[model samples]
Target: MKSRHDMIERYIGLMSGTSLDGVDAVLLEMDAQGKPQVVEDSFLPFPAGVREQVLQLQAIGHNELDLAARLANTLARIYADVVAQLLGKAALPAAAIRAIGCHGQTIRHAPHAAYTLQIGNHALLAELTGIDVIGDFRSRDVAAGGHGAPLVPAFHQDVFASDTENRVILNIGGISNLTRLHRSLPVIGFDCGPGNMLLDAWCQRHTGKPYDANGDWAASGRLHQSLLQQMMADDYFQLAPPKSTGRDLFDLNWLEQQLAAWPALDAADVQHTLLQLTAHSIAGEVRRHCPQTQSMHVCGGGAHNAALMQALQQQLPDIRICSTAELGLPVHQVEAAAFAWLAWRFCHRLPANLPEVTGAAGLRVLGALYPA
Candidate 1:
């Protein structure tokens, strides 16, 4: 085995998941298939009007390809600035980082139709930061007939696998997904549905905060049974595994429609229902797909929300609900670390996608390599 110092290479990970709330950047060091030691991480909120513009383009009421392209450039600029910030904080030069692993801002995530787009151009990120960049981490899997999502399971397996034990790794980003890893089989994963995506939007609409703190707003209100039932009826929930979805399927309009059908319900009732929808859908999917999932280890921003965690526990009492913390990783930083691992895989020319999970026809190397 390599010495500890041999694992001390620097790498930066940049991510803007379906929530689109902000950018998450992290610096980490770890050997291949080893525990990542986080050196530093920071969240840079999108500019005041920036997130809204992306949402407008994502929402039902817009026509602006030009706007998206410009926003892409702006996002890359922000990424570059953050890299500078990271380097400054770490007391390192640009040359120190082995690579910049970027998931980018997902503008359109439609894998079934055979194409997906994540802005924040790697070309620009590479040029501005003077660092090698790896991105576009999903398309090749889609080309192979996979869901092109829940891409972190491979990394999770690498970092979490043991000699003779099983684990379920749940990532609750803008959308929620779970990775069930075990010895003697191909690792598998799938999207469970909205995580913080709907909850964050609901809170912003009602209280002006970016998100519901621990789902406190949801706790203040009660679920609107009508809306809950209607939302639970969504066909997406019933679709088989090997499925993937994004803001395109579950967004403000989607949530609003479920609310509109039950016009008499208060906004709090709507918020309460949304939270239940997230928790229940996730628990239900895990039960359906990974019944052997003994313990569910959570990650992403939503894992810290107490109310949502409580709701999930109520739905799946048979399974233990825990954070990635219990598994030796921080909840908020797992996805960020995922891209870092993806970059490592790319640098090694290793296949980063699982065909069964992404619906890919075969093992494929995901992500494009951009030179410094």
Candidate 2:
């Protein structure tokens, strides 16, 4: 570990996951050996109106092109504001930061259709922040016949790979994804299924809270086993590797349709079942693909949910499950840190996407740069 006195290049990473809650900005410093150290981080939730607008645009609609463009600009302004705040907190000027790796809000991820859309006006961000910006890190992988997601597995391998033991890095954001790091086998990863998206949406619909704090609401309810079985019957779980999914497949409408089959169920019971759905789907994927995984380190907002964590541990009794904090990076900071690492990789022209995980044509240096 470098002392506070060590001078290192700083990079900024901005991420807004599918939960549509907010943007997370992380300022990271990388040493000569390519290890990343977090300098400072910030989280800014979206305004109520902006979050509603984003939710509306998640599907096909009238005048979507115009709305998307406007939303992108709005999101860019928010991102720029976050950049300013991060720089201010770090006591560093914009010039001190080499570049910002911005994972623009993913509006659509349809790799099967050979395209994915992540919208944030990088040009505007660069102009506003007075710093270089790298965005659209997934399009190249999609163009190369890949899922264009779970992209952080490469970063996980770089930072969390262990020679002494097999490991799996699980990121439970709006969507849950896992990366398998074997001591000998090739790294494997993919989207497991819904993470906090369904649970949060349900909580918002029933309790008016943004999410189940520590999953207390979910803990208060009883798990409806029948409902969970029906939910697990979804084909997404049984699909083979090289697969990915997003709000398009697992959104409010989808849940409503599933709930329709089992009428007269309590809302809290439904919330409890949704939580179990997330745990079961994720555990099932790990068992099928990386059964030999010795340890699992979870990250993202879902990691803070004590009930969800307990459910995951119950589902995978043999594997040691814990938050990424044990490994150094905090749960909420891992995704942002990965994007910062991506910016560092882009600066060095290093390949950031792993073909095995994304099913891309080959290793590729992801993202496009917009100079300030």
Candidate 3:
């Protein structure tokens, strides 16, 4: 007979971040103590057409309702396919997993409006996968007077907190965010600013690539001081914590507006400046709020960018910076694993949002379930 700790409980987590790149799915196994380990992982990239459609839906567009609903259905199908692949890789039936925590594609995130929307129909996902699906993880927090963004800090505290060393978990997806984990202080996190969002947009427009691989294009150009300063002057950077932003503020249109003043600037230089902007914005927040953070473990697509990583180290010479891989979790797996943990919390009826981090009136159990 196996002890309670030896019994394996499984959950699936699905995440398609603001990057508009793809969905990451993971099969996670939890122990009796609620500790989770990644047993299997899979990724499904969005086709260029689907990626374009999602980006188009970010702003108000033609036939809004029909387009959104149709795209939601499409996303659900993609999500179901990912679940199928995960189950196949694990060689297990859907009945073996308790639920899937899906952080749907976030097209609009306006916390001040007291609403945030992430597409991908959970009911459809459940119907297709034969597993309970937990989604819409942000609305409850937003309804509770919180920024329903950066819901990963609570999960970060659970899995990445250090009792002996002050640590910060930095996730650089389409939008960069940081979670400070101090031994004595409550966990706090907020979006720092543009991560790969601007970089990828710029690279795609100039180089026709989705992103500047390893930030080599940026590394090739010199940083334009004036352009960098102009971009940094936005009011969003000066705002206090308990605040969050998305493409709602920092989109390609916003970047174009910034560049309207520098019509003749070189594309590589702009890319370099954008990379520095991400690094500086993130470093500024870490210095301002987590002054004592001794180590920062990075997780997300941005971690794989060598140029950006070097820039971060240069921004903070005293703090050690490394990838989450060093901590036993790969860069790309962190966010997906977070959703898995969030699903587990929801299933257990545990409050998964940190009021301190999201500025909710109080803790709230996030994510609504769609039973199969």
Off by over 4 Å in 1: 1-8, 30-36, 59-63, 183-186
lDDT tens string, model 2, 192-276? Answer: 9999999999999988999999998898889888889988999998898878899989999999999997788999889989999
Q: lDDT by residue for model 1 over 186-275, one digit each (tens)?
A: 677888888899888888888988889888889989877777788889999998878888899998888877777666777777788889
Error of 2 at 318 (Å): 1.2
| Number of colliding residue pairs in model 3 | 0
lDDT of 3 by residue, 1-372 (tens): 898745878999999998989999989999878989998999999966998898888988889889999999999999999999989999999999999999998989988889999999999999999999999999999999999978999888888887799999999999999999988777899999999999999999999999999999999999999888988889999998898998889998999899898899999999999999999999999989997888999999999999999999999999999998888899989999999999999999999999998999999999999999
* lDDT comparing candidate 3 with the true structure: 0.93
Tell me the deviation in Å of residue 348 in model 3. Answer: 0.9
Mark the 10 consecutive residues where model 2 has the least summed lDDT: 1-10
- At residue 16, give the lDDT of candidate 3: 95
Residue 80, candidate 1: alpha-carbon lDDT: 92
Question: What residue pairs clash in candidate 3, if any at all?
Answer: none
Kindly provide the TM-score of model 3 when superposed on the true structure, using C-alpha atoms.
0.98
Between candidates 1 and 2, the lDDT winner: 2
For each candidate, give its TM-score against the true structure. Answer: 0.93, 0.97, 0.98
Better of 2 and 3 by lDDT: 3
